[model samples]
Each structure stands twice: as structure tokens, then as C-alpha cells.
Target chain A: MKARQQKRREGRDSENALIFGDSVRKCKTLGVAKRAQEEMVGFMLVILLVAIIFLIFLGLASMRSKSNVRESAEVSQFLDALMELTTDCRITSFSGSVNPYKTVEELIRDYDRDLTCENGEKARDVLTRTIQEAIETSWVFSPESLYQGYTFEVDQTTGSGASSTQERIVELTWQGNAFSCTHAIGDTKSVFSASSTIKARLILCLSRSE
Target chain B: MAFVLVFTMIFFGIVAVIYTSVSLSNLREQVAELRERQALERARQLTGVPEFAFTPISCSSCIDFDKALALKQVRTYQDFWNIKFLRLEVVYPTPIDKDKECSLSVLPPNCGYVDIIPSPSGNIKTKTAFVDLVFWDKNKGAYVKVLGRVHISAFDVER
Candidate 1:
């Protein structure tokens, strides 16, 4: 009679709360629930990891883009200013009298417009001075500065009637660090009438400041 | 529930602070950079002014100041460049070093400054250049070392 009464109590307990009871089906259900919860946590962690990595990469790309824009603006303005400068070099071939002051742009524009001096030697001094000044004023690549190095080149593509093209480059004032390297290029083209066009390219490389 | 709420608030607060700091720093850097560019542009444009200009239509390095026409030209520049304050000081003849804030208002035009506009007050953006100036000074009777210094002050930034 006592054993029969104990069995009835056990049945009552299992019916009331199957989740915490010693019922066979209920135990299996609890095991599955626990495993599902673990998997859900793992998935959530993976999602979080991916989101963090994506955000970091996106931020890095944005910084790089902003840096490039700044460098591009600097280079473009610098080149424009440099080209507008007047040189002591004379371009008196076209006009009757000797006009002592002619800018780089003027010289390039009138390169093929019946110049008495076919060789670019007359304007070499002006080109050299302009390039030297540009280099001197430019940022030097270092741990402190955002700029690494720069190369300013002017290629007299069509105007050079000589044997070859007239290509000139400014002396490099800076060298980049090993880790971070960047380059920004700004171009200027001058076309006079229909004869010849002068193309000039300015490149600025930047480094991530430490 | 209260604990969870407090923890979330703290996390978000930290994130907000961090985000704001980064944004503010970037903004400050950009503003500083813009100020520099503004000064550079103004200086370049000064080269284009015929009164302060030489041979080339626009030459940044060669600035020749004409005493007769400088004041009028400077006023035109004040309008063109939206300049608040413009000061051009020249030191003619190295040995003499005849340097002083020349009052263009004074008669006989003894002052060094064109004095088109009065000096601007408050925050200003300034750029100086050691450029070549071809000035004919009757007193000196020669083209000496006339250094051109241009100081430009833009409007005050409200923020």
C-alpha cells in the first residue's frame, strides 16, 4: 500500500512540472534546449566579430580616401601656382621685341608656336628654378609629417621638334617609411592652337602619421 | 532589469563620447587646413593685382608696388578677396633698413602701408612672403631690397 502511494505522488509531481521532473521525454527536451541556446550564442558572437571587422576596414578606407583628397588638393594648387610664376627666360620669337618675362605655362603654350630656339635650353633655367622651389616648399616624408615623397614631372609630349621628347623631373626631397605608403597624382595639360600640347604630372605620396 | 538598463546606458555613453571626440578632432583639423589654404589663396591673388604686380599677368614672386595707385588697388583687393585687414610693409635698402608702419593717411605719402583698410580685429588668418618688390623710392633713388609682407585677416569664425 505504501509503495502504491509513493508512485501516485511521483506521477502527480511529473504532471505538475514536467520541465524539472524525472520524466524521460522532458529530460531529452531540456538537453535539446540547452544545445540550441549554446549554438545561438556562438552565432551571435560570430555576427559581432564580423561587424567589428567590417567597420574597422570601412573606417580605414575612409581615412585613406580623405588623405588622398587632401594631398590631391595640395598638389593641384601647388602646381598651378608654380606654373603661373614668371621666369626670366625670354620667349621673343613670336613677337618682334624681346619679352624678358615669360611664365612656364606661357613657354609651354608657345613651345611650338614658331619658337626661334628649338632646343629647350633657353627655358631650362626657368624650369629648373620652378622645380627647385616646388621641392623646397613641399612636405618632407617623416614620422611627424603626413606626406612621404613627391615627384613633379613635365613631359613636352608634342612640342619637342628635337630628336626625342623633353621630359623633366624635380629632385625628390623625401623617402617613405616601410609600413604605410601612399601616392596622389595631379595632372595639368596646356594646348595652344592646334599644333602641340604640354602635359605635366605632379605626384605626392603620403604616410600615415605615427 | 535595472542592472541591464544601467549597463546598456553606460556602454552607449562611452561609445557616444568616443565618436564625438573623433568627429571633433577631424573637424578641427579640417578647419585649420582650410584656414591655411585661404591664406595661401589670398596671397596668390595679391600677386594678380596690377598695382602690386609685375611682368606676368599673375606673378606670385614678383611684386612691384606703385605708390601712386596702390591705395586704390588695395581697396579693390579688399572687395575682391573679402579681406578684413591688409598690411604691406616694405623695407627699402638693406643698410638703411627704413622700416616703420607708414601711415598712408599722412600727407606726402610718407607711410609705407597703402592703408586702404584699417587693421582687422579678432581671429585672423595671416600669411607672409619674402618676395621681390621693384619700388621706385624718390628718397632712396634706387631699387633696393624692398621685402613685401602681406598680412590678411578674414572674418571671425562664430563657432
Candidate 2:
């Protein structure tokens, strides 16, 4: 009878040990699963952060490209305006004289009167404004834009070309910087030039009377 | 352990953001620089001498203080040339004699007049006749001067 009791106690102890071992194994598996989930979440968050950064970069690149295109178009417009102004000067060959207005305002007035567009004055104004802006903007890059140089010469005719005189030459020099470059928005500039006859000729004619 | 992992992730996220902003700003600056160079090149190319492409007309006024006038046109071989005013109007068709048309005698006698005296060394002889009158040409680049011999009678104004 004592032997049989010992056997039963041993059996009970083995069963309890088995149950405790199973529970420990289950706890280990649960811990590993929780760690893996945490790692996955962190990796996904990193990818999302990277994606956001990429999007921002893309947006900035797009903005830069657009700006470049706009600048090119502006430059093209300026070239066209300059060509038109130069072409207008060719008329001097026919009239044998130039008009007196050399200022931006005078140019605009003449342009407004002569331009034949449906938009007429408005179109001329716009073109003049564009040229003015370009010239002014050039100063932003180089201050000496307008100070290039001027040459003056005068010839006098008397007694029906029997005699003539050559007058003195004048040279003017300027030393200064007038260009201003700004990276900020809302800054602007304007430029325009009008036709003017050489003042030297008039001065010479007047002097001949003396 | 969880704290260590979160901290690592946060560190990487900050680095990525900084890297991206820097990259974008650098790209923008590069683009701006390239555009500026292109503009400068364009400016240089525009420096050539522009050809005579169009004429200013009918506007009554041109740039450079020049005036547009309704005058006869004269054709020239080149676009630009100096005018050698000739008295030979008979070379072209005319409705009236140029001398009769420009009768300076209609002015009051003794009006301002200039005399031409030519010496052996000079191009003209003494008592030479000359006139002061201006003519316009639509083709010539400058006003044509009416010589004295062409209108000798007009040059004899008593003034």
C-alpha cells in the first residue's frame, strides 16, 4: 500500500511540472511577438518620414523649374522689345532729322500716338514698361549699365559748301555703380529711351551766325 | 528596449529631414546660377551691330530729335551714305522749274544775304553768287542743300 501511494504522488508532481513548463514557453513566445510588432512599427514610421521629405524636395524642384522658365520668357520679351525700338530708328534715314524727345515719357507719348494695335496705348505702355523694367533690372546686376559712353561731333557748312569747319569733340566719363540685385520678391525696375537729334548740330548752326 | 528603438527612429527621421531640405536648397541655388549665366550670355550675343531693318515714317517725329517730312524719295545703293547735293533737278521729272518755284525775291528787298568771294587759292571767285535754302529728300539720310548757281537769280537779293 505505501508503494502505491508513492507512485501516485510522483505522477501528480510530473503533471504539475509539465503544466508549469508549458506556461513558461507560452510567455516567451508572447514576448517575442510583441518585440517584432514594435520593430515593424518603427520601420514603417521611418519610411513614412522619408516619403514626406521626398515630397517636399519634389515641390521645391518644381518651383525652381517654373521660376527658371518664367525668367527665360521675360528675357525673350526684352529682346523683342529692343529689336522693335531699333527698327523704329531706321525712319531717321527718310526724314533727314531726328525728333527731339529723348526721355521715356516722350517715347511713350509717341508710341501711343503711332502704335496701331487694337490695344494701342495699352500695348505700347506695356512694352515700354517692360523695356524700362529690363534696363532697371540690369542695373541690379551691373551698376554701370547706363554709363557706357557718348561721342559728339559737329560739322558746319557756310557759303553753299564753299567752306566747312570741324568742331571740337567732347567725351564724357562716369565712374559709379547703379545696379542693384535683389533676391526678394516685389522688387521692380523700368527703362525706356526716346529719339533725340544730335544737339551738336543745332549748336553749330547757331554758332555760325556769330 | 522600447525606448532605445524609438530614440533610434527619431534620430534617423531628423537626419532625413535635414538632408532633404539641404538637397532642395542646393538644387534651387544651382538652378538660379545656371539661369543667370544664360541671361548673361544672351546679353553678350545682343551686342552685335543691328542692321537697318525698318524705316520710321508718317509719325511726323522720330527718335533722336529727327523730324519726319513729306519729301521726295531718292534711291541709294547703300543704306547709309553722305549726300552730295546736286543742282541737277532736270535729271528727274518736275511739274515746275525748281528755281521759279523757290523765288526768294518775294521777300522784302535788303533782307539778310550772304556774298561769296573766291580767290585764286579759294574754290570760288569774287562776286560769286550763292543762296541759302534747304530742301528735303525722303531717300537721302540728310537735308539737301540747294547750291547758289542753280538759283543764281534768287542769290542776287539786294539785302
TM-score: which candidate is best?
A: 1
Each candidate's DockQ score against the native complex? 0.15, 0.02
Model 1 clash tally?
3
lDDT of 2 by residue, B8-85 (tens): 678777877888888898798667656544443332222221221113332111111111011113234122322112
Off by over 4 Å in 2: A67-70, A73-84, A88-109, A114-189, A192-210, B1-159
Candidate number of the best lDDT: 1
lDDT of 2 by residue, A50-75 (tens): 67976897798678745211233233
DockQ of 1: 0.15
Regions more than 4 Å wrong, model 1: A1-21, A24-29, A32-69, A72-78, A96-100, A110-121, A133-150, A156-210, B1-24, B42-64, B67-69, B72-125, B128-149, B154-159
lDDT of 2 at A188: 18
lDDT of 1 by residue, A1-210 (tens): 999999999999878776556576777899888977876676666556656865896699588766442344445555554555445455445563233455556665664443433345556555566555544444455556666565555555544457545544323334532223454444453433355445666665555532
Model 2 residue A114 CA deviation (Å) reads 4.7
